[model samples]
Target: MSHPVVILGTGLAGFTLAREFRKLDKETPLVLVSRDHGGFYSKPMLSNALAGNKTPASLVMKDSDKMSAELGAATIHKGRTVAGIDTAARVIELDGGERIAYRDLVFAVGADPIRLPIEGDAADTVLSVNDLDDYGRFSERLDGVTSVAVLGAGLIGCEFANDLLSRGISPTVIDLAPRVLPRLLPDAASERLRSKLAEAGASFRFNVSVSRVDRAGAGLKLTLSDGSVLDAGLVLSAVGLRPRTGLAAEAGVRVNRGIVTDRLLSASAPHTHALGDCAEVDGHTLPYVMPIMQQARALAATLAGNATPVVYPPMPVIVKTPACPTVVCPPALDASGAWTVELTDDGCDARFHSGDGQLLGFALLGAATKQRQALVSQVPGLLV
Candidate 1:
């Protein structure tokens, strides 16, 4: 009997690769393993789910069995934790010592929420909505909460704040940076977005972080670095996400900020691959959906007997904040550029230009977002 090809996750990456691979070759036996309930859902919707009045149950697009049938997977292992991988033996060990051999193994394990070590009694009570399970519990906690204190002013944090406001629950946003979206947008662009969100019942506190969290009656009392205390019905930690590398690292697969993979999305070992938020392809770790789609297409081709290297074009992320409505394409890390911005009553148009007068990136807010395609055409591809 031939060993079946196995995938270590059921998230968008795993399912997408499976779907794409089946389109080219269907004879190979396929299996999928998931640690959670194993359902198909758009993870990006979690931040703005409240605004659409969507329940947790409604967010799930397809259950595991349905997805398995649609993708032509022979085995869909739901609620099964993959404890370890024996790359030499070409088998995956389960939690209970059960092992299954694989012809090829793909790691779509995804990432984890970064947890800060806060010196407080109620630090463990702070919540982060990373996955569907986390979102379900967060929704449960929101039943009686009247307000939220969001830690971070980045993409997810700001979107959640906007969503909270739409539900009539005001949010107090705290960030260590002096401005919101410190890593993605220019100062002037961030300020315009901040002004709009503030007008819609969002409060911003910059250059401060939570030093501690203590339970105060039915709410959480947060102690700030400036010796100030803030109270909120619920505390949300949207600090950031770190790619999952423990499992691959333990298996002796090259792991860095993420599981290191070559242009073909292959690990150091033969028949081993990694993609999605877990894989750092040629030193680029993009956790967004667009890059994931690009990786999925390329990895699927390689798995279907076609060796194809992944390429990334100019992909701009649309920030899902109804209050501000922004789109941003960040410049390369090593690029030397300065932001040239113009702010108007309708919106802010900001461009990151190279020294020789070339457009490297752009941030468009409100009405200026209409220029997305035009500006994107000017930006060069991240990887050709």
Candidate 2:
């Protein structure tokens, strides 16, 4: 009997690759292993679900059984943890000593939320919504909560702040950076989004970091580096995410910022591959949905004996802050360019240009977002 194609996660990347691969090759036996319940849901919806009147259970589109049948998987190992991988033997050992052989292996384990070290007794009470279970806990804690202190004014932080406003909860967003989305937007565009969110009942503390969190009454008190204190019903940390590379690294797979995979999404080990937030494909670690879609399609074809390479077009990220309509396609980190911003009455359009005047990237807010398609076409592909 032929060994099954085994996938080590049930997140978007893992399930997506399975669906894409099944479309091309149905006879191949497939097995999916997950650390959670193995439900199908859009992860990006977790942030704005509250405003959409969506509950944790409602967010899940399909359960493990439904997914198993839909994908025609031989077995769906829900709530199972992989102890280790024997790459040489093409087998994965589960925590309970059960082992499963695989014709090919994939790691789509995603990433973990970065937790900050804060001094105080209540520091452990801080919450981060990284998955469905985490969102359920956060939702349960929101009862009777009037305000929240959000750490990090990055993409997730800003979106949550805007979503919280819809539930009549005021959010005080604190970030070490001078402006919100400092990495994604230029100064003018960042200011535009800041002002819009501020107008929608969101507060901001720039250039300051949270030093401590202490229990204050039924809520929490956060002390900032600038010696300021903020009191709120809850504290949320949305600083950033780090790839889950330990499993792959321990298995002798090359690991850098993420599991190092070639352009073909193949790991150092034979018949082992990785993608999504857990993979640094060709030196690019993009934890976004679009890249994962591209990776899934390309990898699916490759697994189907096509040997296709993933091609990435300019994918602009649409910020989920209803308070402000914004889109951004940031330039490469190593790209040498300068931003030219035009601030309008209702919005701002900022573009990053190379020395030769080629459009490298752009940020569009409010009315300026209407030009998203036009501007996106001008920007070069991230990976071609």
Candidate 3:
């Protein structure tokens, strides 16, 4: 018998692809490998879990065994990382001296938190919420903590700050940029969100970067660029995520920003494909659930022997900060355009229009967020 269709990683990307494949072909040999507990859960809910009065265990939807049984696929929990891949032989070498053969392979390795190099014991004390396990650890440390210093003012950082506030914990957000959600929101919309968050009892440290984190007795002390220090009982790093492509790259797959793939989701190597956060499809890698779901369906058909090109419509990322209420469909990474702002007393809406007055993207906050679906329908397909 031929080797099974193997997928690496059990996150949203891997499980969604597995479910999609089973939808078309019920009996195809399928295998899923993951480093974590291999639970079914919405990763976005991690930040909001505490605010919803839920524990880490309560957040998980299903365990590895249940997920495998439901999807009719073999599950390998806590598999060793792929050391390398022999594309010519269709085999993957595990770090544990194990080899897995695959008739078709899908790389959904996902991403990891991007750690910043800094000095002092406080660096070791800083935590990140990237996965369920990480959230569990962070939640345990939240007990009896009064203040938190969150690094980065991006979407995740803002969401965490909001979550902390709802749990009666104060958070001071520090970002090198002048405004929050710099990549997603225009200046006017960002300002509106900043004001709303401020009213909600969140502090900001803009135009300042952390130089080092020193353990100051009972708390962590953050040294900023201006020779000032901020102390917090806990530190959360939400800077960014780095895609897991080292294995694919070592396997001789083309990697640029992420694992390179065509519209059909096939990598440079034969019978090997990549998707989700690990895939750079047509020069775009979306780390959101919307894009992962879109890619899963298209890749499933192609992997099941029916060739289909993945088509992505305009998908707006809804920031889960109920305090400020923001939604955004950021323009393409290299889009060249100027943003025009229309502000209201309780809200702001900014549109990213090209030089030709084409509506490319938009950011909506507060009452303006009601126009998300309407504005999204007017935008064109990204990364054609």
TM-score of each model, paired residue for residue: 0.98, 0.99, 0.96
Ten-residue stretch with the least lDDT total in model 1: 67-76
Candidate 1, residues 10-84, lDDT tens digits: the string is 888998999898898788888899988888898889999998888888999999888888877558888999888
Residue 96 error for model 1, in Å? 2.0
Ranked by TM-score, top first: 2, 1, 3
Q: Candidate 3, which ten residues in sequence have the lowest lDDT sum?
A: 73-82
lDDT of 2 by residue, 211-310 (tens): 9999988989899999999999999999999999999999999999999999899999999999999999999999899999999999999988999888
Off by over 4 Å in 3: none
Question: 278-329 in candidate 3: lDDT tens per residue?
Answer: 8999988889988998899999999888998898889899899899888899
RMSD of each: 1.0, 0.9, 1.4
Best by lDDT: 2
Model 3, residue pairs in steric clash? none
In terms of lDDT, the poorest run of 10 residues in model 2 is 66-75
lDDT of 2 at 348: 88
158 Cα displacement, candidate 3 (Å) = 0.5
| Between candidates 1 and 3, the lDDT winner | 1
